[model samples]
Target chain A: MTDATPSALSPLAIDVRGARYVYPTGNVTALGGVDLQVKPGEIIGIIGQNGSGKTTLTKLLNGLLKPTAGTVIVDGVDTAKKSVQEMAPHVGYVFQNPNHQLFARTVQMELEFGPRNIGLSEEEIAVRVAEAVEFFGLQDYIEEHPYRVSFPIRKLVGIASIVAMRPPILILDEPSTGQDHNTTHVINGLMRRLRDQGTTVVCVSHDMPLLADVVERVIVMKSTEIIADASPREVFADKTLMARTNLQAPQVTEIALQTVVPLGGPVALTPAELAADIAMRTGRPAAARTDAVG
Target chain B: MSMQAALPVAMIPGNSIIHRINPIAKLVWVVGYVVLAFSTQNIVVLYSMALFALLLAPIAGITKPLLKGALILVPVGSSLLALQIIAPAVERPWTPVGEIGPLTLYGDGIYYGFVLLGRIVASLLLALVMVMTTHPSDLFTSLSKLKVPYTLNFMLAMTLQLIPVFQREVGIIMSAQKSRGMKGKGFSAVLPSFVPVFVGAIERVQQLSISLESRGFGSNGIKTSYRQVRGRPSDWVIGIVGALALGGLSAYSIWRGTWNISSDIVFSPLFVVVTFVISATLFFGVVLFAVFLSLKK
Candidate 1:
């Protein structure tokens, strides 16, 4: 994982201070008050239950929503002062549902929509769309109507459409929701690739295994406030925090916490990590250890 | 207001007399109000009809929402009034009232404009009272009791139910488009957002049809409503009396030639002043509300 700390010279990718967002209808307080900072090139996961302000926080970052009370700065720009369209070039947000965004007659056109909207040159738009198409393995359905494609392909189209814009910051709201194993693998690989390219990635999801496997840091939200912000291992290891948030660690981590830790094993977040440690203790190869665990 | 609350009319739960009354009875009153409103051209009687609707607001426990909704109608009513005044249909009794820059204001046109506005307000208010107090299920069951085709009743209820759902979908669609660098403002920007909304709607309708079939909807069988509404004697009394009273008044006014007084009272100073006040309030109220909406955004 990329370092979560920002160097002194680089401005933070996302800086939020005492941010509060109250939905106007019924005065529902979606985000009460919180402070958060995200370093450039960092991969962070926000995990919380419904109405816990995870989505609200991401919305604030892209200027889809302005803080009712505090300030949000995205890449040195104040979100409150900029319209959502102005932030679009800097931050690409992929909503949870693909059906809400997949409108173009073809997947190729869908990828082109964002770059074109931000006034990119035709050649640059073509290059970006082609890159995204190849990276997401969407070439097979590139010329197919977006709505006519399978739902998982449509989800990729939704994400590739934004990724083609080449925003410095990318926010994925529940990228793994309703996704199968293969689709989840694609999303995991995409997040890593984006991080490797020095893009800041913030994902809000309820997929515990995805968060543990992919993110460097995890922010736990409860009752519209951040209850914990730490490394995934640190956050998930806290039994009180897990119980309070009504969240569980990945199954491997839960097993390690219950069985391996009592035997002086290190905290393992992923199955591979646990298998490696088990192999070391057994003085055996990791492949054989993985087989035994399986 | 949030998109979810932008429904044209919605039921507000309450235990008030209006809420407890049979929806069919309330529907009768609605029909009565419409007949009375359209039968009259007397500005005084029309304004009085509007006042009667306003008085029903408190009884229905919807005074606040009704007033808030009325604010939205201001601009619409003013535009209609202005259009009629600019070009009156009555050419014979076109007494010139005054002149503004280039166009002569006709007394008949101004009188007709206010008459139309009053009629709209009265009808709108009565409809609001019925819709706001009666739940959609109750309305459907009541109509079913009247032998309204089950299909028709279901369609009405479904339309009401889908208003909020479609509104929320549109909101999501707009946000999704905006996040992908779509312009946040202008009609051109908004036009493209409708495509996904339409696609989503088609998908939803298809799924709904499948679910309905699976649930045995519209099957040939004896169907029962979860909310059975049996009309009480009081409901019958209210429905008949209310419909008869307004219908009788409308007939009497038509017979006595009191419904049309465009030429006789068109020149009254008090009538002119009242018309001006109502129109000005609507115009300024609409402007202020528009400003408020922009500020909220």
Candidate 2:
């Protein structure tokens, strides 16, 4: 695959072309003939079964692994030409294991690691660190070692460290894994803020509902290739594609499909959306709708 | 960052003589090697000892670790040699070979430097051989069999396990830092990152202690192992032979006063030639294995 020249007027945030990856020792092909593209400021979710190349695809955007057969262009720069360090300012990756990434003595120092590494001025670093701490609600544990904190807080520290770098594109691998509903909601809120600030967010997760609530577009992968890419409504509405990928739509979406769809109501992603759709179908005011199914 | 290799001290699984040797026997062998290393300032003896350890590498299925060990030792041995060459021990009667700037090189200093390098390399390789061949569980069990305190054995086992885990954590942390734009490389760059690793390690230790207590660690009742390894006849033979050879060498070196700095090489010409031949063979064997591995990749 040839290198893509993203035009200045419509610059792509990420462009992957026929990327392939094979593990060094086992020679197992993690990704094969995969092509994907993300537009600027888009909230994208990548979903796939285990070994379906979701994490591998995300890693390619940040120069973590070079494509064996093709090219990955991030922010108009060829990822092959940049080291992970060089790619730091443009793309930030939060690994699944927070303990693996948190290395600073305190939460503040951990948050500052990225900004300091990128050579931000002391004042700018201080500002970003302060902002990250506040944004992540880390004020109480700012002075404490990240390891001494709870796992969920450590995960926040990991996210904040990357966020402090202020990369234009953020790739989170399994951000909602092992997280409770409240913590996932907090992460979803952060994702919304990042998107509102014009940062393109790419998340890979198995949490169907979180993806449904957060991402504008969902990309379904299978056998190392993207098989479906569409809006959440369109993607989740396709029962065959979801089944082939071993995925289920958000539970509320499923409930809406089962009860409301037969009754000529729209497919809803969230309970509120389902409620609104059901209210509209029943000729009732949306705010006065008591129960979605009723 | 490239995936870090497995821990250097972790045992490489195999069924060779070195691997089959009882861990207690290997520990005894390491002790004998250390004793012999310090008992002689003879360069020939030290090189032969190091060569023997290198020869054991292939048999133990740890050629990769041996190469890694050599890489680590080279810089350290060179620096020590350089320090000795520049500044000979002040108490020694020195014959000056040459002068570089304000530094004077002496024959005794140069010879002693080689002796020191050899001693360090030999002991290091011997220890590496033991560590690479024996599993931590087996080592702890052997220590138990030797009547070492259970608490001490447990500590040793935990230390061995934790070192690798911490190494992996350090790698992950470094990768995280690199992604954050850390430009500095090597130990100096990694020094600041150690704080988190230490903190993480402390937390892990606390959790581990709780888990251990719950699992009946330090219990008064008799404990049994899942895999029992009794000392075989070969273990006794190897241990006794190793002890006798090391003891004989130490006695001979003391009798000949070769433990101190000596002007003459002590080994016979034929013995020196054999040592050189064996060392060369082992070195080339390692090189060939590396070449094959690269080609396979």
Candidate 3:
């Protein structure tokens, strides 16, 4: 039941058993015997220092690039044997840079491309496009070219493109990067909606507290293999593991672990819970963390 | 280098039969066909070659014909008009091509001049069609497979990739200057736009060379390609047809003594009327189909 011990009972979304990959051009051994499992309908946080092969794993799951050595399965489908298009309906990946994948002249076209490719009828595609537009409040700029838009708007365009497709397993590689306060809220809200619809979301990010509050589980990879895989409470609990990977525990978890203010065990790793816990423990409470960045 | 998402010569991803043929064979066939066009002025042969090329369009999944043909079209149109216009003006030095007016004549020199223009258009059109449907990578591999000098293929691939980046940068620089009040007088502004493009282009080339080298390009090893280019019987057939067409055209000119359809050789009223009727018929046939498609779309 504790965060320290990962459960074996949950239904698995993707199962990677002993996966390995190498780049022929003087590769620094990107991944070695990497074993990872994502449970269905769970938000798994994959965190590590840069060059820890997070993006590489994202590619492997989407079948963009096959692993050199082991088996990677998404919803029981083998990745190495399938093409990106074949795996596309199941696994949707939102890449780090928004511009690289955006090819259409307008935001509406960009949103329609994936759905169209995967054989969604025009009426169905229109409905999904409408839903995405409404969700992100992107009505005014839907007709504009994504290139002409501002940075935050472009990021939303990129997200809407992926969200419109509605893939079952979504892997977001640092979705929160280059986003401000309002944009961060929008990203969180998007994830919450996907989670509500039973989409399995995996994310790799640097914003530790924000991730801890959102992800149902966390997996830490460094220098090739997984170092820790557990719920947010457990991953943030070990200050030593966080320090090794150049990450810090959520401030509330840290406060729970370090402070004399006995805010019940691990403080929930969330802003609202942290505020309530602090108010109980220390009468003079501080303001709630904004953007979930404690 | 990544900033340069270059559009390769012909990369329409499809399972079409043309895509399955070896890129080297396709290139050879295209070149052979072009050479064949220059070999003759026989109307029958040229029309046949045109028909063959047109048929291959559907097979190759060639979607952008008018745009690709536009490049050849401009040169062809200018040459035809020039031959028809200028031949009448050149006096004394001009060979008596044929008398059109008391003061005017169609010169043989102009007819010979139009030969170069006609051949260029024919060759360029065939080459453009071939380029549209084949993947750049496939063609490069096939070139290497057919012993087209690996270094040259490498150069070709890199250059093709860089063109799009150059175009995009050109776009960026143009926009930047426009915002800063550059008098964008259409073609006139194009020269000014070149200032940034030229400077940036050189830096990009050097950077690209360095990046390619860093990625272990030109290293000593048998280059292994993930996708292989394989030639087929159809490729050879197209090449032969192209070569024969060119050859027949050249031979007919020598034997029949017909350099070109002379400018001064005016068509009769009856002939002109028939030409107009035929042109109209063809035009309406195409228009009817286009209208139907537009309605469907």
Each candidate's interface RMSD, rounded to one decimal? 2.3, 4.1, 15.1
The alpha-carbon deviation from the true structure for residue A102 of candidate 2, after best TM-score superposition, in angstroms, is 6.0
Chain A, model 3: TM? 0.89
Tens-digit lDDT track of model 1 for A80-160: 988888888888999999998887778898899999998989999999999999989998999899988888888898999
Highest-scoring model, lDDT? 1
In candidate 1, the residue pairs with backbone N, CA or C atoms under 3 Å apart (3 or more residues apart, or in different chains) clash, namely: none
Summarize candidate 1's per-residue lDDT along B154-264 as a digit string, tens digits.
Answer: 888888899888888888888889888787556656545888788888889999999999998888865679987878999999999988998998997788675777667
lDDT of 3 by residue, A140-199 (tens): 989998767888888888777777777778888788888886787778878877877778
Return model 1's CA RMSD, one decimal.
3.7
Name the lDDT value of residue A48 in candidate 1: 88
Regions of model 1 farther than 4 Å from truth = A1-10, A282-294, B1-5, B185-187, B228-230, B263-297
C-alpha DockQ of every model: 0.58, 0.38, 0.03
Best by DockQ: 1
Q: Going through the candidates in order, state the TM-score of chain A alone for each one.
A: 0.93, 0.91, 0.89
Over B96-191, each residue of candidate 2 has an lDDT whose tens digit, in order, gives 565556656554455676788898999999898888888789888877777788889888888888877888778666666667777646554664
Ranking by TM-score: 1, 2, 3
